[model samples]
Each structure stands twice: as structure tokens, then as C-alpha cells.
Target: MDFHALQQRLRRFANERDWQPYQTPKNLAMAMTVEAAELLEIFQWLTPEQSLNLSDDQRRHLGEELSDVLLYLVQIADHGGVDLDAAVERKLAMNAIKHPPKKS
Candidate 1:
């Protein structure tokens, strides 16, 4: 799946509904953070084993919440006129430089 294309489609969907006005860069960023916090709530204080045992219903709910977070993050980047893929790549490049491979 082309994430860029998907993001574009989602943007168009929102535009058609006149939702872009509410999705200013700052507001979208805040929404992303809120959704992330909601996603985190599911795992708070839960051991790996306990979390893994979550029922299908719980898993589905978590997945939806996680997707919401990602969508808002994409929207935030889009609203800010940033290419998320390139931004992430640039950050990863910096991280790679910061944590270079160890010599044998």
C-alpha cells in the first residue's frame, strides 16, 4: 500500500467535508498526541503477557485507536507542509550517524 497515496486520499476526504479548517497544523498535532495517549492507555501497567492476552475485541479497539493516532500525525505533517516520509528518513539518517555500527 502506498502510504503517500493513502494520505492524499484521506486529505481529499477531509477536504470534501470541509474538515481541513479544524485540522490546522497545531490542532492536528494536538489530536495526534491525544490519540497516542489513548493508545498508550491500553498498555499502561500491563505486562507483556497480560497485554498479549487481550481479547479480539480489545485488540480491534486498540488497532482503531492506533490508526487514529497515525492518521492525525499524517494530517499534522500534511498541514504543516512537511513530507513525513522524507522527514522520517532524515531523522533515521541522523540516528544512524549517532549510533553507528560497532566494529567487530
Candidate 2:
């Protein structure tokens, strides 16, 4: 996935709507959190097994919620001047050091 392109698309989207002012990192983060809560709501009442076996409609809805979370996250990262690819790499490296794989 070309995140730079996606970021640019999002920028164009907001710019066209004159929404860049409201797209500050703090606001976007808050919106992302709200979307995250909506994503969580999808499985709020389901058993673990049931959550894994969503119906087609449920899966579609889940995707929409996930997309919302991701777009807001991208916007937030862009406003903060963070490269998500590098950030993910750094975080994964930290996780590897924090929790090495067990020898089987």
C-alpha cells in the first residue's frame, strides 16, 4: 500500500472541504479514539468464538469501522510529521527486544 499516496489523498480530501484546520493531531486522535470505540462495539456482546465468525454484514460493518480508525490515524500521523512505516519498524524492533520468541 502506498501510504504516501493515501496520505496525499486524505490531504486533498480535507483541503477540498476546508477541514484542515479541524484536522489537528489532537482532534484527529480524539476522532480516531471514537472510531476505535465503535470498532470495539462490534464485538462488545459476542463470545470470543462468535466474534471470530462474523456474518457477512457484520464483517462489512467491521471493515467500515476499521477504515474510519485508519484514516483518522493517518491524518493524525501526517499532522505530526511521523512516517508510519518507520514508526512501525521501530516499534516492532522494540517489541522484539522486549519479548523475544520462545525456543520451541
Query: Considering every candidate listed, which one attains the maximal TM-score?
Result: 2
| Candidate 1 lDDT by residue in tens digits, 26-56 | 8888888899899899999889998989989
On a 0 to 1 TM-score scale, where does candidate 2 land against the true structure?
A: 0.96
Off by over 4 Å in 2: none
Q: How close is each model in CA RMSD to the real structure? A: 2.1, 0.8
Please list all clashing residue pairs in model 2, or write none if there are none: none
Alpha-carbon lDDT of model 2: 0.94
Each prediction's TM-score versus the true structure: 0.82, 0.96
For lDDT, the strongest prediction is: 2
Q: After aligning candidate 1 to the native by TM-score, how far in Å is the CA of 24 from where it should be?
A: 0.6
